[model samples]
Structures are given as structure tokens and as C-alpha cells.
Target chain A: MEALGVNLPFLLVQIVNLIIVYTVITKWIVGPIMGLLEKRRETISKGLEDARVAAEARANAEKEAAKIIADAQAEASKVVREATERAESAGKDVRAAAEAEAAKAREAAMAEAELERNRILGDLRGQVAALAIAAANKLVGEALDEKKQRALIDEFFSGVKSGKVVVVGESLSGDAAEVTSALPLTSEEQDVVKKNISAKEYAFKVDPSIMGGLVIKVGDKVLDASVAGKLEGLRSTLK
Target chain B: MKRVWARWVVLAAIILGLFLFTGFFGIGLGIKPIMPHVYLPGEKLSETPLFGIAGLYPTNTLVGLLLADIVVILIAIGVSRGVKSGKTVLTGISGAVEALLEMLHGITEGTAGKWTKQIFPWFATITLLVLAANWSGLIPGNETVGLIHHYDHGYDLKQVGPITTIWDEGTDDGEHHGEYAIVPFLRPVSTDLNFTFALAIVAVVMIQVFGFRSQGLGYLTKFWNTKTLFSKPIFGVIDFGVGILELVSEISKVLSFAFRLFGNMFAGAVLLFVIGSLVPVFAQSMFYLLEFFIGLIQAIVFGMLTMVFMSQATQGHGEHHEEAH
Candidate 1:
């Protein structure tokens, strides 16, 4: 130990010097450096946490934006569909109204045509009565009163009423004409009417609606000799 | 970027040119044979009056130790100054100091755990101080430039270096200029057993203190457990014997810690000296690098061993013994 220069006092002094160094190093160096490192670590960790939170917020905002866009699209489609349905129903109403108006006008025209035909028939009846009277005067060589004219026409129409209208295809000797008139017919007038219309049985009929017209009937067939009948045939042919 | 690379190439070329120039010229390399110095008291560089007291002066190794202390203190002050003022970022020398302390702290913390806070100062102190002392020896004039000494028969030479001085070449006339040795102004502090032994004493003492603090008076039972001896004689005898062995080992720790650092550092210094003398050129440079590594390793070993011993001292010896089994 002596040869190695292990001085006792110097060793103690070195130990003391080391203790002082230790004291100084611990107080000033290690303590502050460790604290700084810890602080930096905390700052870094906090920054990372803030970044995480910001990223989460961004994601949430994106989600909300997507939802709003989806809702707007859905609302737009619903509005479009509702508008289409309304337009369809409105078009249907318009078509139905136009069709109803056309039907109404057709019915009115038909009624007017019927009324004109009836009026024409009434005018023709008066003329036919005058003509029949003139014919009777010439054929029988008699002046007939209002009652006699009615009797003469009735006798002629009685023959037509008994199914005595002769058909063109059948034999005229077996068929007879039954005439209807507004007035009575005389026996001579009846003979004249019979000579004009062939029949197996002669019958005469009177109707006030016919005024002075003559109508002959044979089975289901009817022949109009009156002015009213001639006018009705003329109106049917015009239609 | 091209400019920066060109600058680097220019700088490297300059360095290579300087190296080649110096290598050829032998401008700095000392080609003399660097003999190993014994682990004895260094030759005196100067003598102080000390109020007329005898044998009061600074030896070469003592000057070296003081110089090492100054360097360490400067480094410590540099490291502490900015940190003391609460600065967050450090740079340059302070940064290096902080890095070294942090690394040492990490290693010590693993071995010492919570006790590291209490023990780290001593650990760091020994390491940095020893590291400085060890590296100080590698400087150009550490054991080279100093006072010249002449051996005399009338004077007690044993008080200085080894009685057998290699540089001594006695003349026929016995003139003082006949045989002499260069007593350098500085020698590495760790080359002296005193420094290593002192540090070891400090470490071992602290360990004992930690043991007492942790386990109370019961900590001494590991050295002499009479209670076990009375209960189980056969096993107790072995236990007591092991306890004595443990005590011996504890004492031996001081010697071990001292010799381990001293031997490694002292050997490295001698090797560098011898290699520098023999090969001198690039060969000594490689040894310098090796010495630097050895110095660093020796410092770490000293500090880590202290920390380990302190940690073990705080624990129960029985548990440690069981673990060993």
C-alpha cells in the first residue's frame, strides 16, 4: 500500500472532494434535466391528445354533413313525387269535364230535332184537312158542313182501321185500308176512299189529333194519306 | 447541396494532407522508448515552504490529481450553471455533461431503483472524477514534461520513487548529472492507489449506511447471526461461517473496487507510455483510442459496482443467499 502511494490523508481528502462534487451535481444537474425531460414528455403527450380530439371532431363533422346531404336528397325526391301526383290528378279532372260537356251538347241537339219534327207535323195536319174536304166536294158533288166533313173522314178511316191497307206484293182484292181522320166521313166518301184503297174489310177511325188528315192501316203496316203523315215522312227522310 | 458536399470533400482532403505531412516529417511523434512507471510516489515537481514544515510539497501525482479536479469542477460548473437558472435546453459542454449524467442515472436507476436517488450522486461523482483523472494521463506532457531528478546516496531516495530508478546511470565521479529521471508535472490520479482506495472507501461506507437505513440494526446480523447458531448447530455452523465469509467479502469489496479501477487505469497508462516509445507513429494513436475506451469502462465499472453493492446491502442477506443456492 505504501509503495502504491495510498496516503491516508489524501484518500480522506479525495473522499471529501467527491462528496462535494456529488452534492453539487445532484442539486444542479440531474434534478433540472430530469424535470425538463418530464415537461417535454407531458407537452408531447398533450399535443397527441389534442390531435386525437381534433381528428375525432373532424370525423363527426363529416358524418353530420353526410346525414344532412342525405336528408336533403330525400326531401327533394319526395317533393318531386308529390308534384307529379298532383299534375296527374289535375289532368284527369280536365279530361272528365270535357267529355261531360260533349255529352250534354249531344243530348240538347237531339231534343231540339225532336221538337222541330213535331211542329212540322202539326202544320201539315191543317193543310191535309183542307185538301181532303176539297176532294170530297169534287167527288160527291155535295157541300159538307163541319159535322158532315168529320163523318165522311171517319167512314174512310174506319176501313183503314180494320187492317185494310193493301200491300204492293199482295193481291189488292183481298186487302183493305182503314183510314183515321180528324172528322167524320160520309158513306159516299167512304166509297170513294175504298175505291182509292183496296181491302177485304173496310173500317173508319177518327182522332182529333189528326185534325183533317187521313191514316190507313193494314195489319202492322200504316200508310199516311193525311197532310200530317206526309209531313212526318218528309221530316224522317230529311233526318 | 453540391456546395456542402464540395466543402466536406475539401475539409477531408485538408485533414488527410495534414496527417500525411506530419507523418512523414515526424513533427509531433515522440519516438523515444516510453518505459512503464511503477505505482510508487512520483518525483516532486516543486516544494512549498509550508511555514518551514518538512516534507510539505506537491508531488507529480498530486499535481495531476489537482489538475483533474480543476477540469472536473469546470465541467461540473458548466453543466450546472444553465440548469441552475432553470433553462430547458442545454448545448455544447453542458449538453455533453447532461447526457453523461442521464445515461449514468438510467443505469444506476435499474440497479438501485428508489435508492438511486440517494446513491446516484456518489456514483456519478466517482465516475466523472475518475474518468477525468484517467483521461488526463493521456495528455502529451502528463508523465513526460517535468522536473529532472538526480539520485544521491546521502539522501533517502525511498521517500520519492522506487529505490531502483531506471534512469539512474551513476558516473565514476558521482556527479548529480550522471543519472536522472523526469518527474512530470502531472500524472493520472487513478494511477495512484490512494485515489481509488478513497473512492472505494466512500462507496463501501455509503453502502453500509444504506443497509443500516433500510434494515436497521438487524443488517449486522448477516455478519454474526448468533441466534441461528443456538437453534440449529449443524446448519447454524455453516450459516455462521457463511456470515463471516460475507463480512470478509464486504471488506474485500473496498480492496476489489480500488484495485479494479487502479489496475486497469495504471496498466493503460503504462501501455500507452511503452507503446508510444516503441511504435510511436500510428501505433500509439490506436493505443490512445484503446486507453480512452478502457478509461470509460473503468469509470463505469467503478460506479456500477458501487450502485450494485449499495442495492444488495439494502436487502436481506438470507434472501440473497437463498437466491445464490
Candidate 2:
């Protein structure tokens, strides 16, 4: 009965107590705790699932937002590019139109200048003739007869070479015509001079005070047959 | 009805056979007896009280009850095992047994709410085993055995009739010397106060364990109970005094269980002895029948009280009041 001299009643009580404790812990404490743990686990799992779903939703929304921003940027860039292209094309058209207008204005100015130059040249030519006539009149002592002056101019021009005489004057001859017709001209010049100038009794009468004498003009030479010219010849003979 | 009759018939046959064997051969069969009066090992051997302040000591009855309790535990474990494994046959048998145990557990737990299930296994096992051990005394040779006499004064040996010596012996020299009348076989274990006290101590200790397990350290505070006292100082002193009384009452539970069981069984034994000795013919048989019923009833009452008191001790007073309501 005394295995280890342990109090038998005490041992019995301990055993009984152990049994009761085990039973109570198992049935009451452990069972409820397990149930609570299972419920907690389910709740945690559901929460995790919901969190995952929310996270996914947030990610999707973010992605959509990014896509929208990207699309907007692309659209904005597209609009910008289109606007730039239109601006460039408009600028090129405007530049080309300006260049064309400038070229037309230059052409018109050149033509107008050419016309003005020609009109001025004509007026100068008349002034030169008037001056030449006044100088000649001053040099001459008296007026020569028209027929005598014509004979003298013929006599002076008959002594020169046979070539066309070119007269530069303001008007066609009146008194100088006899002297101009007495001169012979080259064959080539004859045809051209006959078409361009008057051949019969041709004269270039600038002015009557260019001293009423026959002045024959040839290529580079001029012969003066006037009263002032005879007096200058006499004076030179005395000296 | 037929099964009940068959059980009765079998029990009668067993009794008849035992009676014949004991009456004719006097073979000294079954349990060996050591004394005319039952000797509880704890009371005889222990210098300290069996369930002293230190706690209870193990005795022969305690050992027997423990063995019986172990068997009950094993059976319960087996039943629980079957329940876990989904075995149909074991499940069916276990279910029936578990249902009975569970019903008892439910009643106790209903009183304590969720706490009863925790203590149910130990409580039920102790109750059933103690009940069985107490009733075992009614078996044929439990109280009847070959006799050996102690000296009327000292240590000399004598001889006597198998069961008659318990009443006849006294000190031979009249010097107030204590001597034991020895028997060759069986003793009714319950007749010993030591055995009953050991069982009570175990029940009491288990009640504490259950209380602690259910309510934690708060259970110990129930004994002191200063909360209400604090509110009402004069009432508190009285309540504190009552707390001391409660401690005393707890100690009395051991005495109650021990004295009640011992008194009943011893009284029944004495009655059987007187009746059988006075009229050795027909009255002996009649007394035997009465002893049989008395033994069963006493065992049942002891077990029932043990169950009830243990349940009460572990439970909170509030729960008891609620149940009463």
C-alpha cells in the first residue's frame, strides 16, 4: 500500500483534482478559446481579402488615371503639333506673298525711272542746241544771205570726202538744207541715212542765229561757212 | 421486463451458490479478513490523521477506490476515443455511456453553467467508484471469514466461529488493553471511518481544484468574502466570522461523509450480527436480505451525497441561489 510512503488520501485528492482540472480546462476553456480563435482567424482572413480587393481597386484606379493623363498629354501634344504646323504653313504663305509684292514693285520702279531719264535727256538736248546757236551768232559779224550761205556751204562740203553726213540738231534744216544736200555719202550710209534722215536738200537747222551759214556735219568733222569765220580767216592772214 | 427478471435470477443463483459453499465447506473463500472489526489501514498505521492539515493519506480503501476510478477513467477515455475516431460500435456504446455521464454533467454544469463539464469526469468517476466500493461489501464473504482470536488480555492466540467473534471479544485481563480479534478473510471496507474520510477528503480537494479552475484565484476570496463586509462594517465583522465558520464547515465535510457512511454500515453490520446470532435459523436469512437492501441504499446515498456536496462546494453561492430560484 505504501509505494513511496506518500499520503494516500493526499494522493487520492491530488488525482481527483488533476482529473477535474483537466476536464474543466478541456471542456470550458480550451473549447471556447478554440472557437474564438477560429472566428478571429476568419475575420482576419476576410479583412485581408477585403484589403486585397481594395488595394487592387486602388491600383486599377491609379492605372486608369495614369492612362487618362497620358491620353490627355498626347492629345495636347497633338493639338500643339497641329497648331504649330498650321502656324508654320501660314507664315510661309505670308512670306511668299510679301516677296512677290516686293518683286513687282521693283519692276514698276525701273520702268518709271527709264521714262523719266528719257524725258530729261530730251530737254537737255533742246537746251544744248539753243546755247550752240547763241554762241555761233555772237561769233558771226553779219548775217549771210541764205542762197550765198547755201552756195558757200556747198562749196565747202564739195571739197570733203564722199561719205554720209550725220547732223545732230533740234529740228530739220531750213537754211542749212542746201549745204547738207550737196555732200555725198557712203553706199551703206546712203540706204540707212535715206530711210532715217531726209536726203533731198537735207539740213539740220538748229537755229537761224547759229549764224545763217551752211554748217556741214560729218562723222567727226564740222565745217563752218559764216561771216564770222571769213573775218577770222582775214585776221589770221594779217598776223 | 424479461431482462430485469433474468438479472434477478442470476443474482439469486450467485447468492444461493455462495451461501451453500460458505455454509457447507467453510472454505474461507473470497476476501481474506484480518480482524473481527474492520481495520482501516490509515487509522491503524498512520500516526497523523489520514486527512490532516497536510492533506489525505492513501489507505487500502483509497487504493481500491483509485483503481476503480482508473477503470472508470479508462472507460471514459475509450468512449471519448471512439467518439473522436468515428467508430460505430464503440461510438454507440460510448454514446450511451457518455449520454448518461453527460446528463449528469449537464445537471451539474447547469448549476455551474460552463464549469461542470470541466470537473465532470473526475466527479463522476469518483462517485461511481466509491458507490461501487461501498456496495461491494454486500457480496457474500465480505464480512464472513475464518476467525483467529487475540489473547483476552495480551497477545495470546485463540479460535472462534468464522463471523461470531466481532461481538464476543473483550480484554481478557481487564487492564484496558486493546486487542484485535483477527479474521482469516474479507472485511466490509466502507465500515471503516478512515476509508470514508479519505474519500471525503478527495472529494473536498477536487472541489477546490474545480473551484479554482472555474473561477481562478477568485475562488479563494469567496472564503474570506470581505467585499460585503467592507460595505457594512458591523455586518462585515459578522460576515468575517461567518467566513471562519465556513472554513470550519469545510473541515466538517470529512467528518460528515466519514461518520455518516461508517455509522450506517456499522449499524447494519451490528444489526445483521445481532439478528443472525439471536436466531441462527430463519431470521439470519431475513436479516441478510435486509442488509443487502440496506447496503445498496447506503452506498447509493453516500455516493449521491458525495456528488451533491462536491458539486455544491465547487460552485459559487450565487449559482446555487439562482438554481433555487
Candidate 3:
């Protein structure tokens, strides 16, 4: 009556309306939206799982590639080492073959020199005997016999100097040392001694079949005055 | 059939109880003024007319009707609660009542569904309550209280005819002077403008509430409804005039709701009173029947108008006007 102030009925109506609207919307709209959000959450989780699996697969592939590369590198290194070792061994084999061939060539040269020396010694022996008989006949004015000459040669060899000398004969006795005459020492000889003498001396035996010549050696220096040596010098000059 | 008879018996018993209560209070008591008259605030209770307005005022009948309306609405809600979704007594009543309300709501909601839902409950409740209050006054003895008379001047007196006065005025011969009296036995609620004005204020305030709830503070601008008033000078002037008009219209709603119901019910009561006074027996019965129908029709009209005005106030003016057209 007093201008119809706020009343219980109006308040009740407002409250009732609010409740009805809230209930209906909660049942219909909000519930459906919540369901949609739940589905979206599941989808996102499945997507995350798929991404994780893909990442793992990619990592495995990378590891396998790395392993293959490592294996290839190891194999390549082993091949290089084997090839290098084979090349080194081939070089060593070539060196060994060359040395053997040089040794055989040196032995053949030494045998050939020995055979030539014997043939020259045979010719020199005949010349030296003839020259000795002529020299005796000139000195005594009479011919001497071969036996007596042989005995005299022995006596002269035995009476010569006991130093190193060269004997030119088919065969030299262990005691043979004689020469036709003792030669004077020349300036050349002294020079040879100064130039060629070594601090340590070595003795060398020459098998010379030229019996009339005397050969003397001191270290590497040699003096030869024999029929074979004279005939080799003559042939060299004529040619 | 028994259930129907039982319901009628209960209704009759309640009616009888209300009648007996009224009769005991109305007829058994003999006061100095046998008929109760009211002195409104700022109104004199003398037999002399004040500014040509009636001197004898009635009790505030609107208060009782308002109280009864509240009780009726509460009972209606309780009864409706017993109703299930599609089946129940209230649902059947609602099916009949809702046909017209639904049609009105459809029109309001055609363009303003969003706003109407906010105000529909208050609008429907107010309409139904006011309607029930108005119609209840059509019952017998509602406007038929016995008549009594007071002295044209301000004195108590002894009785002159069959009507006995309880108080006397001094006489010239040292004897008491007697005065004639007339009194009635019933009164109707709506016959008073105060009751109708109260109802009108409730209806108008409810319209404002719906408007505010629907559109918030913007609803105040409905009185000043204009587009680009400042930009176009001539249209601005017209808009200003229209704003004044809108204000006048809102002021007129108080007069409209109050006077319409008051005039109708008062006229009906006066017609019945005149006819029954002229021909006591048959005219009383005939006019009583006429009053009953008039009361029902007026209640329906008042409720329907409240509903329409409230819906219109809350809804978009352009759409509703177009739909009305």
C-alpha cells in the first residue's frame, strides 16, 4: 500500500528464475562443452605419444648411420695398412735378389781370371828356359846341361833375400823366393810405398804361370818383371 | 462425482464461514453510527461535503483485497507444485490459462526473446494476482453492506424512523432531538478509487521493474527515444516533443489503470444499488447477476491489459509496434 515496496513475492520469483536457468544451462550447454574438452585432451595426449615414437625412431636411425660409418672407416683403415705392408715387403724382395746376382757375377769373374793366368804362365815358362840357356852360353862360352842348370837355379833361389817376392812359375814351392837380380829401389818405388802402403798389411798370392818373372807385393802395390808381363806390355803397345 | 461434490462442499463451507464472519461483525454490533464510515488522512468525516467530494468515506477495502490476493497466489503456487510436467490439476488449469498467455509471450518474444525471459515471471504473477483480487469482489455481500446516516450538522441524536440512532442531541424543551439514518450492509473493494489506484501503482511499478531488468538503465531513455537529435535540428525539436509526450503517456498510465477499473466497478455497484433500492426483491437478484458477470469481465480485461503493458514495456518498441500493426 505504501507504494508497493520490495516484497517477498518479488524476491522469490527472481530466485526461482535464476535457479531454473542455471540448472537447465548446466545440464545442457556446460556438460556438452566439458565433454568436448575431455575429447580434446585425449587427442592431444595421443598426438604427444606419436611424436615421442617418431623421435625415438629418428634417433635410432641416426645411431645406425653412425655405426655404419664407423664400421666403414675401420675397414678402410685395415685395407690401407695391408697394402702398405705388402709394398714394403716387395721392395725388400727386390733388394735381396739384386744382392744374390751380384755375388754370382763376382764368383764367375774370379774363376775366369784364374784360368787365363795359368795359360799365360805356360807360355812364359818356355820363354824363360830358352832365355836362361842363351844367357849361360854367352857368359861361359860353352853349353851347360839341363840337370846342371836346374841345380844351379836351386842354389841361386836359396841364396836370395828372404823378403816378400813374386815367383813366376807353373808352380811355386813354398820356399821359392829367387829373382834374376836384386833391382835398385827407384824413386817411383818409394813414391808407391808412400802412397799405397797401409797401416796394416795383407799378403796376397798371385798364381802366375809365367815362371821366369819375379813378382813382389807389399799391400796393394805390385812389381812385375816376367816374360808374360813383357809379352802383355808388347801386345798392348803394338795394338 | 463424489470428489467433485466434496470439492463443492468445501468451497461452500469456506464461503459460509466467510459470510457468517461478515454477518456477525456487520449485523450483531450496534454502535452509535451503525454503519462504519472512514475519515481518510487529511479528509473530514462530517456530513458536510468537502470540496464536493463525498464526506462519508469507506474503510480501506484495497488492503483486504491485497491480502486475499497474496493468499490466493500462494495457494496457486502450492497447488501448481503438485502438478507434474504434463499431468496434474494445475497443469490442466495452466493449459487453459496458458493458451492466451503463450500467444502474448510469442508476440513479445518474437523480437525481444532475450529481454522478455528476464521479466516474464514477474509480469505473469502480477497479472494473475491482481486479476484474482478484482474478481473476488464480485461475491455476494462484497459491496452490499447495510446503510446508516449521520446528522447533516455535527451532533448525535435519537432515532426518527425504523432506523434507531444511538446518540441524541439536546432539544429546546429539554427533550432529546431525533435524526433519520440510512445504512447499507455491504461494500465492494474496487468501488473505491483508492483500491484501484493502489492496484494501478503496483501494475505501473511492475512495468518499470520489467523494463529495468530487461534493458538496465537504458530503459529510462525510452521516454527520450530519439536517434541523432542533435545532428538534425528539426528532428531534434521533434524528438524533444516526443520525449515530452512519452513522459505524459507514462503519467497517464496511473490515471488509466486506476480510473478504468474504478469507474467500471463503481458504476456497476451504483447501478445495482439504484435498481435494488427502486424494486427491492427482483431487481436486486437481477443486478446481482449482472454485477457478477461484469466483475469477471473487468477482472479479465484488467489482467490482460497489465500483461500487455508489461510485455510492451520490456520488449523492443519497434518490433512490438510492428507486430501489433
Whole-model Cα lDDT per candidate? 0.71, 0.53, 0.52
List TM-scores for all candidates, in order. 0.62, 0.41, 0.39
The lDDT leader among the candidates is: 1
In the range B1-91, model 2's lDDT, one tens digit per residue, is 9999988986786666456333446652322112234333422223355546555533434444454445445555665565456443334
Candidate 2 lDDT score at position B296: 58
Q: Count the backbone clashes (under 3 Å) in each candidate.
A: 32, 21, 26
Chain A TM per candidate, in order of listing: 0.34, 0.42, 0.36
Q: How far is candidate 3 from the true structure (C-alpha RMSD, Å)?
A: 27.9
For residues A72-122, write the lDDT of model 3, one tens digit per residue. Answer: 999999999899889889978887888788888888887787546645654
What TM-score quantifies how close candidate 3 is to the native fold? 0.39
* lDDT (tens digit, per residue) of candidate 1 on B71-141: 87787677667766667677888787778878888888788888877887778777888888888988877
What is the C-alpha lDDT profile of model 3 across B154-257, one tens digit per residue?
33544558754445333456443534333433344465555566566766877787778766777766677455467768866676676678778877987898
Which portions of model 2 show Cα errors greater than 4 Å? A1-239, B1-103, B146-149, B153-181, B282-315, B318-325
> Quick one: best DockQ, which candidate?
1
* Candidate 2 chain B, poorest ten consecutive residues by summed lDDT: B28-37
Q: Lowest summed-lDDT stretch of 10 residues in model 3 chain A?
A: A157-166
Q: Report how far off residue B197 is in candidate 2 (Å).
A: 1.9
How large is the interface RMSD of candidate 2?
9.3
